[model samples]
Target: MTQPAKRTKKDKIGSGLKQQSWILLAIVLLAALIDYIWYDAHWVIAKSAALGACLSYLSQAIFAGFVFWHTGYRARRHIVRQMYRGQMVKWLLTVFGFALIFITIQPLSAPALFIGFMVMQISHSWMLWRIG
Candidate 1:
């Protein structure tokens, strides 16, 4: 009898990352709509909400991509090592992302941005709970 091929660690990581991304995107869009309608239907507020949500997600996505770029093609034996490296990179990217967003986006709505971020971050926990 032939045995099924084993999946690589990279494949497992990719699938989990994809699920995370989708959850973030859905929550971001929903938050954007709520921000728009709740905040006097202002485009600025809506845009801010969307940007904040996207930036929050981008922070993680960029790091995930970096992990894939640096480790995905490497030997599977190095996965555990790569995970630690990936986490450090993710943290750095997240800090840099927030700094960049704050510095570049003028007339930014702090409340909207923070609300979007908070909602999305909270949603992540909710998602994990549901999944687990």
Candidate 2:
């Protein structure tokens, strides 16, 4: 059989970025839909779940933004430093996001909220698993 065509660094990076973003969205939406139907959620529960999932998605988006933003860098030190900064930024963003959500939204469903957040976070494993 013929070998697959080799991908350039740009192609590889772009593919993974797009794949993960699209897949993450799909997984979260599917999960939220399932949650809504299974729980027969009213507006409060449904809104809480959406907010939680949005926070989770925002964290990953921050990480991906920082990582991809520096792909043009040639220095290894710069790349490593940027990655470290990305982790810190992601953490801070997550904390802020959760705080903001909790502060603004009343009568939040902790169980549903966590379920949405955790489900989105756990999707990363399946994404990586498909690669290896």
Candidate 3:
């Protein structure tokens, strides 16, 4: 009888990471919806919204980390290089960019933020599917 091939550690880790990414994506979308629909639009609620945004970004970072790690790529080194090279500057610019838009446009920020969360969730889900 022929022996079965052994699965690599990378494959195991990738599967685990994929599962985690999906769960995080679901949580992010659900949280965003709940905050939008039922939460009071007060300072405390805004704090909670910010917390959710940070969590969503953190999950995206983790998903990226897992993708790089499983593929034998230097994830943190690449992120650092990109940050120093230009991405961080652009990211900072966008922070103020969105703030300005939020202030001047007024009505667009809520939907825009929710859409951003959805985009992140979809991207994470896609990455997970790729790894799986």
Candidate 4:
């Protein structure tokens, strides 16, 4: 059996991102489970939980993707400008996502949606602290 090649700094950063992604997934699952128990196994609660998780994950992912793509081959000023613009677009996307969910999903449980989102949002800070 051969040993794996040593990883570069970029590889390490990629792995760290993967770890954070998994943590986000776990947070979503836990939120769903809590909602299931709190709402007596109602499907609506589960749906709301899923939607909330999707919103959080998608928003963060889109922003990260844009940053990674734009900063790859750019000057420092260009990167900085893109970062600011990316933030504005990311926030817009997030708000649009939430609005779409609320408008489309009838009888949604507000608590479930918020709880799911909040857990993932807070997990970002938790992951950063833990990683540090």
Mind giving the per-residue lDDT tens digits that candidate 3 earns over 12-65?
A: 555655565565555555655665677653233333334334445554454444
Q: What is the lDDT of residue 68 in candidate 4?
A: 53
The C-alpha stretches of model 3 lying farther than 4 A from their native spots are 1-8, 40-132
Clashes of 2: 0
lDDT on C-alpha atoms for all candidate structures: 0.66, 0.68, 0.51, 0.70
Give the TM-score of each candidate. 0.62, 0.71, 0.29, 0.74
Please give the TM-score that candidate 1 achieves against the real structure: 0.62
The order by descending lDDT is 4, 2, 1, 3
Write out the backbone clash pairs for model 1.
Answer: none
Please tell me which model should have the higher lDDT, number 3 or number 4.
4
lDDT winner between 2 and 3, please give it. Answer: 2
lDDT of 2 by residue, 8-118 (tens): 254544465567667556655665676568776445556666677777777876776676555443555666787889999989998988888888888787776787678
- Of the two candidates 2 and 3, the one with more favorable TM-score, higher being better, is 2
Best by lDDT: 4
Displacement of the residue 67 alpha carbon in candidate 3, Å: 14
**After superposition, candidate 2 runs with Cα above 4 Å error:** 1-41
